[model samples]
Target: MGCSPTRHRSQLSKLDSPSKLDAPCITQERSIETPGVSPNRKLLLAYYANETTMNGKLKGLFEAIFAKEELEVTTIDLSYHNLNVREIYHLQFVLQNFQNLRELKLNNTEITSKDIKRLYSSLELMPMMQVLELQGNAICNEGIKYLTKLFFRTMKSLKVLNLSNNRFGDEGIATLCKGLLSLRCLEELRLNSNNIYSRGLILLSQTLCQIKTLKRLGLAGNPIDFESVRVLVRSIRSNVNLKELDLSRNGLSKQVKYMLPEGQAVIKA
Candidate 1:
């Protein structure tokens, strides 16, 4: 079957902020394009990145592609746009239009709990979504609460989840734990450098042990101590499906060696 005609729409908008230091920066006014729409729109890639300098021409390209109806939009590098949520909360309109979206990346932005809730609310409408990356953002425990809730209640097709580098410590982890109890299909999870302690890591390990389909897990740069690593060892020693486990740059000591015959663990300096 051919792609939907509404998938072809073109829309663009730009906003700029003053910069203190110069390092590959693109002014908002010179970045995004104006709004336009076409029925033959088929593909959408929304890379709203930060730290990546984008010119107005690139913005115009993204907007035009994003506006197409029924188009599949994949968002990455959302840092270019502001994350205040109030200013461009209307962007959700653009977000909700992509019924065929697959991948979404929102790393290093200032997304808060409210923004997460809004995103979750819209996620229900997108049934085909599979991968979601939200690393390096400030979505704390509250935001994780919404995420876990969505994982349990709404987004069932979700496969890969990258939540590394957020400050979702014990509280956030606990909230996520409750919601992920039923996510049986989640395969890969990245939680590096999130300040998760022994308690939270243990709880997470326990949760993962119950999951049958999960394969890979990344826990590097967390605050997990030897005690937590022991808990992890105990939890996954018997796991049958686990293929990859990244615990690099954490509390693991040189004296501590790999206990699992199949899995790998890295030590920090």
Candidate 2:
């Protein structure tokens, strides 16, 4: 069965000088105002409603919100929105403004390597970003090269990263691991269903032992082999920080589960 797409709610919080106002939660209604709140404070609340079409609706919404002033947004979720070239350009503008953003979700947005290159400078400004989800995009090996720079330079505090189904094979995996070692606060990493094989797993296994903060790893739906699995098991065997390893639907035998460390949990087929 195909997995359902995850919908992420955007969380926007604004902090102004002196007195602090409570941030209103953004839902389907996209309400950004509350009673008894000052007009200035209400103006600070920016809501990005989910848009089915990216033609003029998305652009108009962004212009309406940003026209007042630059919003101090913390989270932005634009998942499941098929963005064209013009829409992606507007997104880059938004990212450029939100320097203090903490979370950004662009799952299944149909972004490519060229788009990633364009957004590189904007992404560099977000030093405090914690979560970045780009699952089901077309960010192949070329995009991974740009991400490697971000991982080494800016995204030191990134905690969760989901890159599943991006088609960044063993070459991309090797390039990604080069920068993954620089992350000091990464906890969860999802790269499942990415057309990876034993070679990619071997490279990733070598890198996994170094990331002491990594807790969960998702490699399911890949065509990994027995020898690489053994290599992976040995590499992370002494890694006490790693808690869960997902290798499900990889055509591995049930006996492969016994190869894991005593305290580690493996989800094998």
Question: Which of the numbered candidates is closest to the native, going by highest TM-score?
Answer: 2
Count clashes in each candidate, considering only residues at least 3 apart in sequence or on different chains.
27, 0
Cα lDDT tens digits, model 1, 1-269, are 11111122223334333232223221122232325443323222333433144334334334544444333445433543445443234345445555556666666655666678777766666656578888876677777877877777766778888988876787878888887765667888889888898889988888877876777888888877887777777777676777777777874645345656643333222
Residues 57-118, model 2: lDDT tens digits: 34443544544443346777777766656567667766765677888888987788778888
Error of 2 at 16 (Å): 30
Return the clash pairs for model 2, or none.
none
Q: Compared to the true structure, candidate 1 yields what TM-score? A: 0.71
RMSD from true fold, candidate 1: 10.9
Using lDDT as the measure, the top candidate is 2
| Model 2 misplaced regions, further than 4 Å | 1-64, 67-71, 266-268
List the lowest-lDDT window of 10 residues for candidate 1.
1-10
**Whole-structure CA lDDT of model 2:** 0.74
Q: How many clashes does the backbone of model 2 have?
A: 0
> Where in model 1 is the C-alpha error above 4 Å?
1-62, 65-70, 74-82, 86-88, 263-269
